[model samples]
Target: MTRREFILAGLGLLGAAAAGGVYSYVHRPKFGELPSGDRLKRMQASPHYHGDHFENLVPVPVMSEDEGGHENRFVATWKFLFGDKKGLVPAHPLPTEKTNLLALPREQDAVVWLGHSSFFVQLGGCRILIDPVFSSYASPLWFINRAFAGSNVYTAEDFPEIDVLAMSHDHWDHLDYPTVMALKSRVHHVVCPLGVGAYFEQWGFAKDSIHEEDWDTEIKLSATLSVHILPSQHFSGRFLKQNPTLWCGMAFITPKRSLYYTGDGGYGAHFKVIG
Candidate 1:
């Protein structure tokens, strides 16, 4: 073939590949739906939502130069692709142990580490599940952020009826698509900050079941159990639009015990505020 013809064919192939990728990204359920109508209005009501994006309580030192979300994302992606990652992943399967969640006594409080950022806390006679990412990989694409072997032993089906599905943020790692979808029936209610409940609503959860709140607010889950949605130094977005939804840390306070989850945020004064 002529060099001109070969170059033309290569360009055509690249165009087709790009188009295919765009289509997959648009139609896939894994990408999730953005907030609209009442959800958007509710989000706008929050003091955090400024203009088109959400903001931290104060100018976060970690994100002072974050006026451009797209640029920060580009830098992050560049690092993920070509940056040094020598010991980021384990070379061998991680040692893991499984617990029969159903057999655990609900009356006796306990905490279970499902993997990564996921946790199960039985407190104040309530079965509380937090950040339950049962999927092997946290990213939208399966090839990236693969879990260590033997670490992903638990699935959404393994859990018993959950009283509270507490989500700290809407990041893919914390708010897993498949795991939450499967547990929706088992989850009695969901507690998320600000705009994060839009995902649950779009995924067919009843509006009444989703309790969306702003930071610095405390939710009385029961007479003896309460949860505090507090500020954190972090940005949120599943796709490109950063901080469209709020990111937060949580404080679960019971009569006899109190626990906190940082939810992927960097250290900030919010820690003292949580106290």
Candidate 2:
């Protein structure tokens, strides 16, 4: 082929691939489902729910400045995506260790970080998992948001029976569909923000197994164990609507010890309130 023909053919192939990607994103099961019926009703009942979307306690826009702030998020995002990516990733594989998670005694208190936002914690005799994204990547499209080398040493099989599966939001990073499907048989209960339970339910988890609540609401897990669904300054969406589900942080409280997991957000007065 001529040089000009080769370039034109390459452009056509690129266009077709982009088009196929868009179609896949729209139809993929990994994107999860949106809130409806009772789920939407509960979400709308939340004080943070505005006309069509959930609002942060301080109204922070995603990847952009709010009304009074300058509008530079578009440029920043473009630079983030297609610009020079130096320092964006580690030059070498990160150091890692694999712990025998199932071998730990039930009474022993422990916390294990399993790449990105996933965690496994043995607290107050309960095996609690949070933001359990064990998938290799974290997006509707597999090519995006990939995990780093050696970062994910643990898998669903590594976890014992989970007493409480707490999710902060429905973002792809925090709520991975493949990981959830893999862990469905082992988890007993699910906890998440206002509208996030819809995703769990759509993924075949029993509705009774999910404990969805608004921010500042506290859930009693056992006599001595509780979780506070705290407010976070963030937003949530998949390929569809924005902020249809709420985002949050979590505070696990025991009689003698306490821990907090800030899922995703910005600095805000809600932090003071949570403290």
Candidate 3:
């Protein structure tokens, strides 16, 4: 083929690829449905929530400028796309252990780690589940960004009735769509960061079931059990626009003990503050 013809063909292919990517991204879900009207006005009133988006206590820079005094977005993204992933995933089938959550003794406090950031905690006579993502994949599409084999042993069906379902953010890895839909009937109270409850409301959860809180706010889960929403140097959003919601750490305080869960974030002075 002629050189000009080859160049034209290559350009055509690149254009098609770019168009396909844009179409997939825009059509994946409703982008602007996060929180609007009264919900957005309420979030705007929060001290942490700036007029446009939520802000962390301490100013956190996402990425530092290099010695060259410029950030190469394309090069950085390319490196991340093809970086070495050693130890990020298990090489073989990991050993699986299943504990019937309903059968566990309720008198004593216990904690079970269910892959990634998910966990089960029984404390102060309350059964709490945190950051559950039982779906096979953690991305908008199931085929991409999948969980490792054997890492997803537990499903929504395996969980017993949950007293408190706490979510730190709106990221798909922490808050899954299918799993939440499945557990909707079984979950009594939903505790999550500000603006996160909007997603639950979209999924048909009763407004009374969802309790949204800002940083450093406290909510009484029961007469003897309480939860304090602490600060974490993190941001939140499900789609392209970020920090539309607040992300936070949580402290579960019972009569006898206090347990802290550090939601996903960079290490910062907020840890000391929380301590």
Candidate 4:
């Protein structure tokens, strides 16, 4: 083919691939279902829920001044996809430690980091798993955004009976459909921000198994275990739309100690307010 024809053909192929990706995303069942009817009404009545979407207590731009604005997200994303990533990853597989999660004593308080925002914590007789994502990739595409080597060491089988499965948000990385499906039978309770439970509901989890809360609300799981849902300067959504559900941090407070998990968010006055 001529040089001009070669370039045109490449562009045409790229356009075709993009269109196919869009089509797949629109039809994918694992993308999750949205809230409606009574669930939608409940979300609408929430103080943080605006008529069209959820809002953070303090306003923070989705893109910063340094990022250059809304359009710059695409630029940054392009750079991330194509830029030189020499030191972006470890040269060797990262080392890991194996722990028998099921065998651990209930009296022994501990915390285990399971890559990214996922963690398992045992405090005050509660076995809490936060933002558990065991799937190979963070995105809906099975092959894209694969987990780093050696970072994905734990799966649902590694976990004991999760007394409380705390979800930070509805982002694909935090809430993996396959992982959640695998864990649903093992987990006792699913706790998350208001409207996020709709995803769990759609996944076929019992309504009694899911608990949704607004920011600053508290759920006392047990006599010694209480979860405080606090303000976080973040927005949430899994699809093209944004902030259909609320996003916030979680503070696990026990009679003897307290631990806080900061979900995804931007720096703002809410940080000081949280402090």
Candidate 5:
């Protein structure tokens, strides 16, 4: 073929690829359509659901300039471990006992942040864990890396008779495999958004003990405590294929008060609606 013709063909391919990427980004799924099973199936079948968009809300840190001298030293240490050339270990280290959660107060009216999206809430003589990720790093592959500092504040052994284990979504950071396995015997009930129960079932949680709810659905835990599945602006994926399950936030309500957990999300107009 002529050189001009070859170049024109290459340009045509590039244009088509760029157009496809734009189409995917502009047409990705929104959280409002997630609750219905039929709507979720339709979204899963679409090509736009798994595509990447280049939008950024928060400014990216200029590593060298913004990190100061200490960050440079830390990066140098990380390179020595996981660089392309010589390295002793992986990208990060496994967190030690220094980060683990020690003990819950016997008074039973407290909340502790377990790093990332996990939390332990003690109220009305009940312990509730929300979207616990106790691992070093949030990754499907075991060999990658882990959180640089906090590993696990509390292991499963530290928990005493969990009343409700709640999950906001199926993402690795929100729904960790190891943490779920540890809670299998101690947790009495597993609460999750629709289709998230599949993960619990796969992890050997009893079918009857799992409660799946759509958006706005409510489950009563006790005379004074209840939980409701709420909407979130996020996507779900564990592999290259995406949106096989659902994602959401949660609202915890008691006779005296209500608390909202906004999982991982971008700021949307729904915040006004929530208020």
Candidate 6:
């Protein structure tokens, strides 16, 4: 074929592929539609549903000040190239009771980073965990590669009976299989973005215990505790197929305090909007 004709044919194929992908996503079975089997029923909403804009994977705008000058230009370019490699090595050692202070009973509000994006938060006599990753590395294939250094100060065995478990997304690192299964019997509620609860239900968590939410939705945990799903600049994937699931950050607001958990996100205007 002539060069121009070849280019036209390639463009047509690209358009066809894009149209097929959109059609599949729009018609895919939602979590509620899936068979319950032995699993519990699905929840109506999650405290951490941010929004559906994640369907369009647009990079958040970077500010000029944050971008810096030509000298720093390379930094931005390098990050764009290798940013996903950040989690290749563990950021810090697995937190211990001394390091995370999770063992202490707190009368006031407190928050501790478990590792990666997992956090142990205590507020108003209630304990909540966000994206609790306890495994050495955030990977499905654990034997070949593992997390760098840190060990969980508290394992699934050590976790107190939690009032709320807020999962930001369904990435293996954030939503561990073994960890969630262990917490299933003890956790009062599992709040997650839409479709994530399906994973828990499949894992045997009670249907009444799993609550899923769409973007910008809110859930009242108690009279004094509320969780709001906020927008995040990020993508999600557990297996090779990308964007099969949803992702978001969370804002936990209590009568006495407010905290934001950016589960795993690229820095974006959403931070400034939250501030």
Q: Going through the candidates in order, what is the number of backbone clashes in each? A: 0, 0, 0, 0, 5, 11
Select the stronger candidate by TM-score from 5 and 6: 6
lDDT of 2: 0.86
User: In angstroms, how far off is 263's CA in candidate 2?
Assistant: 2.0
lDDT string for model 5 (1-275, tens) is 89999999999999999999876754433111222355445434433333321111233322344344344746764874577753533466556443233365545467777767888877666678899877876765455545545455567777777788999877777878777887789899888876677667656789888887766679886787788876666766555434555566787787655778886767765566666
lDDT for each of the candidates?
Answer: 0.85, 0.86, 0.85, 0.86, 0.67, 0.68
lDDT of 4 by residue, 209-274 (tens): 888998889998778988988888878888788899888899999999899888877677766766
Residue 38 miss distance in model 4 (angstroms): 1.2
lDDT of 2 by residue, 54-162 (tens): 9987756566665788887778868765788687778888899888998999999999888787889988888899998877788876667778878877788988899
* Residue range with the least summed lDDT across 10 consecutive positions in model 1: 62-71
Cα RMSD to the true fold for all candidates = 3.7, 4.5, 4.0, 4.6, 11.3, 9.8
Clashes of 4: 0
Span of 10 residues, lowest total lDDT, candidate 6 = 31-40
Give me the displacement of residue 183 in model 3, in angstroms.
1.1
lDDT of 4: 0.86
Lowest summed lDDT over 10 consecutive residues: which window, candidate 2?
57-66
lDDT of 4 at 234: 78
At residue 201, give the lDDT of candidate 5: 69
Tens digits of per-residue lDDT, candidate 1, 34-112, equal 8888888988888789998898767764322356643375566677867887998788898988999999989988999
Task: Give the poorly placed runs of model 4, Cα more than 4 Å off.
Answer: 1-25, 65-70
Residue 60 lDDT, candidate 3, scale 0-100: 76
Model 5 ranges with Cα > 4 A deviation: 1-107, 143-145
Better of 4 and 5 by TM-score: 4
TM-score of each candidate structure, all chains considered together? 0.87, 0.87, 0.86, 0.86, 0.63, 0.66
